[model samples]
Target: MYWTERILSEAETRNSGTESLSEGMRVIIGGATYTFSEGILRQERLCREEQEQTKEAFGFKWKKRDTYESPSVKRAHREWLLKRYFGGESSEIASLLHGRENFLDAGCGSGFSSLLLFGDHLASVRYLGVDISNAVDVAQQRFAEKGLPAEFLQADLTDLPFRGPVFDVIFSEGVLHHTNSTENAVSYLAGLLRRGGMFLFYVYNKKGPVREFVDDYVRDHIRSMSDQEAWDALMPLTRLGAALGRLQVEVNVPEALPFLGIPKGRIDIQRLFYWYVMKAYYRPDWTDEEMNHVNFDWYRPSNCWRQTPEDVTRWCAEVGLRIRKMDVEDAGITVVAEKV
Candidate 1:
């Protein structure tokens, strides 16, 4: 079925007991005609100022989308996604996605992550990309350029248009934490899943006390910066990370510092500083611009919330989701859960 008909059919099911939402109304978005309703338009406008800042930050990040599409970068991200969320096997990933009827890329930016993880299987499911930023326009264009059939919508995740267990699979990566409340966002999205449907997501994990403090301090300093200014300001930090990484030095911690969340083991100096102090993302093989992109993503956004493993488990349970798998890393927590 066409995107319009599919969306409207779901909308109709959601609004069944109420009056129809302006039946026959049509709207053009990203050069495609889509059925729209007054309710959708109203909800689209109900965004907070911070969310707008986030939208602008990521809008800038994703508009420079070419940086993320390089083959090496795509491969790295695909391997991470597969290993962390899908049990590290292409067949396992396929089993979860291929037969699903509806798949949502929640907080999808430029649709690159979706393409990286499951572009091959998009044909088997009705794909929908949602974001608050104008990156939806970029996503629509990219998918079109690839001759892939998908729909994109610009909307806030906190208050989405569709209602009541309408999606079969929802994938959100490193995005919910950028919302007003990560827990609230998780609850809302989990409620959109049908029984037995799956929800896969990644969220920043709460770092050590000193690291958390530095992260918040830097965010405060840069929250007022324009997107370009913020990007420029982050270059020094990125370069610092690169320089430290090149030192090729390792330190052995003789004992653990429980108070600081430092574990006893062999650690790289760059990683020690990054994990215990502030974020200076380093990838020795990547360009300075690419490393800066990672740093800006961490410090520029105003709503980057980090949670504990306990927090993630509690949030999923509160929303009727049973955790099927979870992976914890120094960078974040990854989860694959199903609606009970």
Candidate 2:
């Protein structure tokens, strides 16, 4: 049956009043019965819980124990941005900001990225962050305590509440691919961007058939696991990544393999292993808990989608966006585009 037809049928079934659509009540939709608000609420709760767990595991500083405008806090934010962005080229992200008059941080979790990007320029830029989970609350509190000028809303990416093209820039990193439909989310975000405004985002790359299979196999089994259980289960995989990084072995390829994007040169085994065998690169600064957080991030999400460069380019073209730059790395594909 068509999707709209299925929705109508489900609506008709619900109208029969077999089950009321209450907070915990069940509703049938598209021939599938699911707890109405409860299911969504539970998912939101789980998402928030898992995020907090991972953040704690990753040793993220939640509260600002120091002074509100302490230089230490600023320093910490800078260090985080450098580490998160590959090649420590976070300046490139900042360089994309032509006009900091207004900005939107789509899916801003705990507002850390916003802090790193515009913490100093908060008084000048009208920054707004929207997230689906209760992390918005955490973000709001953080901003409030710091006396930063920013706004946050708890909303879904598929249906952003705002209207018209009012934003100068929209930044969403490691967010769209986690949604139900990355393409739809991109289109929605594009509509919110003013003409000539930039839309910067990162989406998971289609790494290859084998890596795809491994990722799917692991995620399928762990999606339903509890936070602690997922952490425990991923421990071994994280260890393997750590062990590989410790090997410190280097090899030189005789010829360049253009198809696989491998250049003829000396390469570190740990880095190569992370790009091929597994993706659990260990950082000396990260604790064991942080490593588990990395693994959990990989296996806990149910809607992780990997798209190719062609898919990203096509989507941008469909949305009337002109690609500025596209960076492909081991982590994912980062695209900076401007609405045309």
Candidate 3:
């Protein structure tokens, strides 16, 4: 059966009391019940558990610090991320939405991305942020405290409650890869875009076999670990990344490996090591707390699928999305596509 149909059947069955639905109860946020179909409820439970693990892994203060920082700092970070992910033509994505208004931020974590990307023009555009976790509560409170006009909803990405062709722009960064089916999630989100609307997202790129093996090895060992235990276990990896970054070595590669996405050229040793050897490298500018958050994000998630450029391209085409910008980085693929 189709996943959505199966979920509806499950919802009906649960509503009929065949199974104890109360066992799946979640903490109510803002005194509102955001329940939809049974499938979404199941997804909500999973998302809530994973994000709660994230919250516990990163802690509250570190997650909220950026949102409360000075406007200049926020703007600088936004610009830095744009350039880092989108390259020199970063502005092109923003330019695509010049006259567009309604925006949806799927999988908005702590509202940091929303603030960094659109906080400057919150008054002019209508923004709605949605997540299947209690993080939505945190986002809503942060935006409300700042007096920004934004809406927050606790909804699953696979089955978003919103209607089709309603949003002019949909931004989801480092989110879809963690879903039950990244391809299906993309198709669902694509349908929500209005004609000519833009969808910008960052998803994990397929790292070479060696790196993938290490990531899986570490993640498998830490999958069932408690929050503190996972942090302690991953600390060494974070430190290794920090130490490698400090080495400041450079190397020259003689041949291009198309399969691994490596071009024949001179490259920084630290970057090469992190990208090809061990992905534990930490930014020199980040505090230890920030570094831990990075490590936890990498090792804690149960689902982390990496895709190739061709995979992303095909997915976009299948969903009637024209590829606008496709940037391949060490971390993942950042795509900006528009409805065709």
Best by TM-score: 1
Which regions of candidate 1 deviate over 4 angstroms?
1-3, 6-46
**Which residues of candidate 2, in runs, are more than 4 Å off?**
1-100, 252-265
TM-score, each model? 0.89, 0.71, 0.77
Judged by whole-model lDDT over C-alpha atoms, candidate 3 comes out at 0.68
Candidate 3 C-alpha error for residue 210, in Å: 0.9
Tens-digit lDDT track of model 2 for 208-246: 445566778887777666756776888888888777777
Residue-by-residue lDDT tens digits, candidate 1, 30-104: 233434442222133636876778888898999897567777778888898889987778788778875577888
**TM-score, candidate number 2:** 0.71
What is residue 274's positional error in candidate 3, in angstroms?
Answer: 0.6
Give Cα-based local distance difference scores for all models.
0.82, 0.65, 0.68
Indicate whether candidate 1 or candidate 3 has the larger TM-score. 1
1 against 2, candidate with superior TM-score: 1
Error of 1 at 35 (Å): 9.7
- Pairs of residues clashing in candidate 3: 241-281
